[model samples]
Target: MPTPGVDRWTFGVAPLAQTVELAARLRRVTGLALSLEHAAPELDALLDALAEAERRLAPLASADPAPRVGAAVDGDGRVYLDHSRHIGAFNPGFPEYEIVVDGDQATGTVNFPVAYEGPPGLVHGGFLALFFDAAIQHHNCDAGVAGKTAGLELRYRRPTPVLTDLRFVLTRSLDGGRIRSTGELLAGDVRLCEARMDAVQGDRARLPPVSPRREQPGPV
Candidate 1:
C-alpha cells in the first residue's frame, strides 16, 4: 500500500518557458527537415545560424553545474519534475503521449510521427520498448507507488505503423515488495507489442529532492 497525498514524480515541468518553446520549435524543425526528400541550399545559412547559437551558449552551459534531471520550479510557481515522455525541458527527442490512470489500469493514446519511422513507415522496435517503460513508470508514479525497473521484457507481435494513432493499456499489481506491470501497444483492435516488467516498489518520499538549475538553454 502507498500513502495518500504523498508527493509523486510528475511531468510538465515548464522550466524556462522560452527554452521549452525553443525546444518545441526545434522539434518541429527537425521533423520538417527529416521528412524532406532533398535539402535546400538555403539551409546552409540556417546551419550556420545554429552553429553560432551553439557557440554562444557553450560557455554559459559549461558554467552551469545544476542538473536538469530532477524537480524544478515552473513559471506558475508550481514545482514539477520532467520524467514524462517529453523528457527534459530542453529535450525534444521523445514523442509526447497521452495517458490516464484509474485504479490498477492506465489508458493512453499516442501518435508516432514520421520522425520515429524505422522500416517502411513502421516505428522502430527500440522506441516501442522505450514507450512501454515510460508508460509503466508513468502509471506507477501516478498510482501513488513506483520504483526502479528491475527488469523489462518486450515482445513484438506485429509491425507498428508510424504517423498513425495508437493506443496503450497497462494494468499493475503490487506483490511482495515488487510492482508488476503488463501492457500492450495496440492499433485499434490489433496488438502490435506486449510488455511485462518487474520493478522494486519505492516510496514517494524517497524520490530525490528538487535542485536549482541555471543557464537552461534554448534550441542550440
Candidate 2:
C-alpha cells in the first residue's frame, strides 16, 4: 500500500518510480505535453497563494526572539547572527530566512536592520552577497543536494536599505551533475540585486568534511 499522506499524483513506491508515475498521471490528467515552457494556471495560483500567505504571516509567526535553526552546515552545524531571526521571521521585525525548498527551487526573504547599513542606511554589498549565497546554497540543500560556491556574479541595481523587506527567488537549475542556480533580491517592487551562482554537489573533501572539527578545534 502507498504510504499514508503520500499523494499518488506526486509519489509512488520508489522516489524515482514516483517521478515517472507522476509524469504519466500529469499527462493523462491535464492532456497537455509536459515541458518547462508550459505553465499551469492552477499550479501557479497555488504557489502564489502559498507565497502570499507566507509573506502575510511572516511578521506575526516569526517574532520569537530566539534562534530556532542555525546556519547551513553539512551535517548539522550551528552558527548564530543577530539578524538570523529577522531573516527567517514569521512575524514583524523578525527574520524570514526559512526557505521553501521545492525540488530544484527555493525562495525566502529577509528584513535587515539599521545596523547592517554600509552607506548611511543602505545595506552593504558584502552582506547582500552573503544573503544571496546562503539562499542559493539552501536551494540546493532542499533539493537533497549540497553545492559549493564555485562562482557567483552579482549586479547591484539599487541600494538595499537595512530596515526593509527583501524578497529572494532562486531558479534555473541545470543538469550536468552540477547545480547552477540564479537568484534575485527585491524590495517592494524595486529590484535590488540580481545574482547567478554555480554550486556542485556537497562533497566532504570539498566542503571541509568535518563539522565538529571546525565547530570546536580545542585551543590551538
Candidate 3:
C-alpha cells in the first residue's frame, strides 16, 4: 500500500514556489521551441545542446532534496496557492488566469497561447474543461466550501479561440455538504463552453495530514 499523507508529485511550498517561477520560464521556452521545430535544421544543434545541458543537471537537481511538506494546505486540507498542479496559480500547463470573487460568484480572465491549440487557431477542448474546473473550484474555495471534485460535466458550445483574451465565470451553492456549481467560458460576448461541477465537502479528520518542517537536518 502507498504511504499515507505522501504525494510525491507535490513539493514543499517554498521550493515549489521557486520552481513555479522556473516552470513559467520553461513554459515560454517550450512555446518557442515548438514554434521553431519546423524551422531551419541548423537549430537542431542548439536544441541538442540545450537538451544535453538539462540531462546533465537533472540528477544533481533532485539529489537529496528537502522533503515535501503541506505548507500551502489549510486546516481543512485545502491546497491553496500551490503553483505546480493548482491551475489557479501561475502554472503554465494551465492558462495563467486571475480571479475576482464577489459573494457567491467568481470571474476569471485568461488568454490562451498558441501552445494550447488543438484545432488550427482553436483552444483544445480538454483545456477548456480544465479552465472551467479550476474556476469552479476557486469559486467553491472562496465561498468557504472545502471539498474535492466529485464529478464534472462540460458542454462545448463552440470552438474556443486561442491567442485571445477569454473570460470565465463560476458560481456555487452548498446543499448538505455538497457544492453544486456551474460555470461558463466566453470570448467577448460569445459563449464558448459551459460546465457543471459537483464537489463533496468532508471532515478534515478523514485525511492524514502532514505538517511543514521548520528546520532542515544535517547531511549524514
TM per model? 0.80, 0.50, 0.74
Give a tens-digit lDDT track for model 2, residues 9-100. Answer: 11101223443454444333332322235676876875787699789967533254433332333433232232211222222222225466
Q: Write the per-residue lDDT of candidate 1 for residues 1-220, one digit (tens) a residue.
A: 3343454455335457777788678867777788778878767878999999999977655343444434433222223436733452355666668887886798999887766779998999888887788889878887877889999999999999988999999999999999999999899999999999999987755566554444445888
Global CA lDDT computed for model 3: 0.68
Candidate 1 Cα errors over 4 Å, as ranges: 1-7, 10-14, 64-81, 84-90, 214-220
> What is the per-residue lDDT of model 3 for residues 72-104, given as tens digits with 9 covering 90 to 100?
233323223332234634567776777876756
Residue 130 CA error for candidate 3 (Å)?
1.3
> Where is model 1 poorest over a 10-residue stretch in terms of lDDT?
72-81
Name the candidate that leads on lDDT.
1
Instruction: Quantify all predictions' global Cα lDDT against the true fold.
Output: 0.76, 0.57, 0.68
Give the Cα-based TM-score of candidate 1 against the true structure: 0.80
Query: Which residue pairs in model 3 clash with each other?
Result: none
List the RMSD of every prediction in angstroms.
5.7, 18.5, 7.8
> What is the alpha-carbon lDDT for the whole of candidate 1?
0.76
